[model samples]
Target: MSEKVEDRIKELEERLASTKVNKATQKSINFIKFQLARLREDLIRIASSKKGGGGGFGIKRTGDAQVAFIGFPSVGKSSLLNLLTEGNTHSKVASYDFTTVTAIPGMMNIEEAKVQLIDLPGIILGAAAGKGRGKEVLAAVRSAELVLVILCFRSDGTINLSDLKTIRMELNNAGIRLNTRVPKIVIKERTRGGIHFTYKGHQLMDADEVKSLMNDLKVRNAGVYFSEPDITPDQLIDFIFGNRIYTREFVVINKSDLMKTPISPEKITEAIGHEHWVMISAKNKENINTLRHNIFMELNLIRVFLKPPREEADMDEPIILHRGDTLEKLCRKIHKRFINDYRYSLVWGKSAKHPGQKFDNLDHIIEDGDIISIYLKR
Candidate 1:
């Protein structure tokens, strides 16, 4: 069965490679891509079933946010982990490859938030297909809120773009989408009706093609809404599979001290085509502060202070919440009964219309540095 799926995937790949991207062939190309995505999803399911679904790294998530370190073996992952956590973690560091064979957990304290940093085993070329603990590593990565791709400079002071590409491909194959947003497509199903697709703006594929794809997926009765103009068939597959993990990612160029000449940030940005790259020598503790700040900023965490009625806000220990978290969620986090006895909430920050604004809307979203005081029924 797997062999047949692989053969079909290869055939589709060949066809897609040879096909031209013109208006006449666009629908055919989209259909081929959709078929390929379905086949890949099937392959992943079969592989997971064969593995007995029991080989993933079983690390409980902790801290305000979780971050994972992923790279090739001996790429200074352990060193970076130690530096990030300030030697609070006990990952095995060595000059040889594959020194750390399991996921090492660490806690990084940035201001009031304690971010959990995980150092997983190195990923190889076929890591996504369950090679050399690749599945376990990716499992850890899926649970993380952020990913740090650590790259080591070559002996000639040049960054290896191939290494970065390999790592990214592995992550992509594992269904972990880094720094990507979920497609703005929503599907609603009814018990007895044909598939209906309603879209706005310019769609990538016509409604008939979308209905055909839905029929292929056995979705006989559904209403598909395409809110985004550029929704692709692969993204539709992703939404259907519903297991793909989307998270933020940043690149770290480790061992910068080994370079004969310092690489400028502009050159690095141009090389990666991303502004999220940071260069640091973990062994020498250089630019560690900058990396920490970047991590905090990318996490989109907001510190909200709590205050009792007629009392000053507790600015010393603020509750950490992700950006766009609602007041109801915050109340539930504070205490389950707070929602039941909720009266109103006073806010003092950017989220408020005016300073110390009072509102009772449970759906009110909180902002960074906001001071919130919850009032409940007496």
Candidate 2:
């Protein structure tokens, strides 16, 4: 079944590539894309059902977020991990290839928050298809909140663009999408209603074509809401399948000191086509602090202080939260009991209109340096 599905997927992909994508066959193109998506989903389901062994590392998550370092062998992942952890958790570092066999877990402390960092095994050209235990490493990476793609800068001042492309392709094939926003789509099934789509901004596809494609995908009776400015067929397919992992990514160019000629940031950005990149020397600990700061900032974290009813807020020990985290999330993080016991919360920060503003909405978004006091039910 898997083989048949794979062959059909390949055929559909070829058809999509060959077919001219103009107004003459736009609907047909979208239909083909949807068919391909369904077949790929079936392939994944079949593979998961017949799995003999789960081949991935077992690293316990113990921080505000998990960040994985991925690259080819001897790309200085281990050394970077050591630097981030301040030598508290030393991964085996060597000048040779494939020194670290398994995923090594380390803890990085930023303010009062702990970030778990994983140094995964090196991947080769075909890592996504189970090469060099690439599948296992990617499986570990899929669970991370952020991925750090480490690239090597050779001594001759030449960066391997081919290696970077291979790593990106491997991650994409492993269902890990880097630095891509999730489509703001909400599809709700209905018992008795034709497909209705509501969009806030410019529509990418005609309503009739979207309905036809949805019906072809076996979504006959549903209401779809698209909140994005523009949508594409591939984005729609990804949304319906819902197996892709959308997460943040940062590129790290290691061994920058080895380069005889220093490369400008503009040249590096043009070469890599990624704005969020940093060049550093993990061995010499050059720009390690900057990397650490960038990692923390890229995580989009916010610190909220807690205040009692009559007492002052604990300004020193602030509750670490994400940028858009709400009062309900704060309650859950503080204690699971608070989830049901809390009545409302008073806010005094950028999110609130005035100091000590009473807010009953649990979904109100909290901002950085906010002071929140929760009022529980008696």
Candidate 3:
């Protein structure tokens, strides 16, 4: 009976795919999917209930992770999106607030990662408490897997650290204490080093001594570092996401074009104290690829393209899948029923060494560039 219902839902999905469903209908489809997921959750409750009453809407949170762009107005949220996707979307940036009347979203290609970064209205203080456009923006921030807070370059060259605090407060108001939940990475112009660094609010002195300094501060397993300057982005990424640093933000120092009396890589490492920082100009197309790599490593995101049973493959029909998508999540995504009765699935992708490998749907961990065909028990 349950399998029949799943088949019916799949048929409905196919019909919906055939028709031109508007945004509302698409949302309805999501609602239906959510309802089915809720029903699945109610399995235990149903068994326990002697006609038990409480039945309400619930969310089936998937590993379909999302990220949102947030910050004060003219803070380069939209601009960063443009740089990431290379798509010309309207930013409407001004010196003051309220440039965007409606929220805009765009899909960005972070190398192998396909992330959707939504450009939201400028968030102000006290949004969750029902202050200005803060509420609307805060709601968007709450729905993200991670956040990129851009403190951009001004003519004066002083990035507003205070606004960072206020935006954080707004996030908290929206019930997202980003400091605790997600990894926060700060991107800004370099202080003196050509390399990147993280800001830990500590000052270091002496000759090539970060280890001795860590011991002095009693900081154990704080983060990883390269032995020399000019290390590739891969090394930096490994050093960053390799170990958990508790609550951390990947610090990137931008605007290398404007750094006066530039500092060496060692000095760059020291600028943010211990946090890793990357230097780049999104406008100038500088090291943006490296930035993308770091985000993928940090978020543990994987991108996979879906392939059909086949007629003739077209380059136009390749739909890239991203997010924190594991195999288990993919089963739920393809069909909620699959989640309930999933046996296993087979996957092949750019990352997989063995093509057409079978994976236990429950245990398979998805990686970037995986093309998968799920085999379910009919």
Alpha-carbon TM-score of each model against the true structure: 0.87, 0.84, 0.52
**Which tens-of-lDDT digit does each residue in 179-245 have in candidate 3?**
4422333333333443333433332222223333333333344443333444332222222322212
Worst 10 residues of 1 by lDDT: 47-56
RMSD of candidates 1 onward, in order: 3.3, 3.6, 21.2
**Which regions of candidate 3 fall more than 4 Å away from where they truly are?**
1-65, 179-258, 261-277, 304-326, 337-343, 346-361, 368-373
lDDT of prediction 1:
0.84
Once superposed on the true structure, which residue ranges of model 1 sit more than 4 Å away at CA? 1-55, 190-193
Q: Give per-residue CA lDDT, model 2, range 1-378, as digits (tens).
A: 555765676688689999988977998999888887676555444433333322267567778888999999998999999999998999999989899998899999987778999998889986655568676788778778889999977767777656888898878766677889788999999996899988889988878888987887888999998888788878888888888889878999999877887678898898778789888998788998889888988999889999988899999888888998989999999998878887889999899999889877688999999999999888
lDDT score for candidate 2 against the true structure? 0.83
Sort by lDDT, top down from the best: 1, 2, 3
Off by over 4 Å in 2: 1-55, 186-212, 221-230
CA lDDT, candidate 2, residue 311: 91
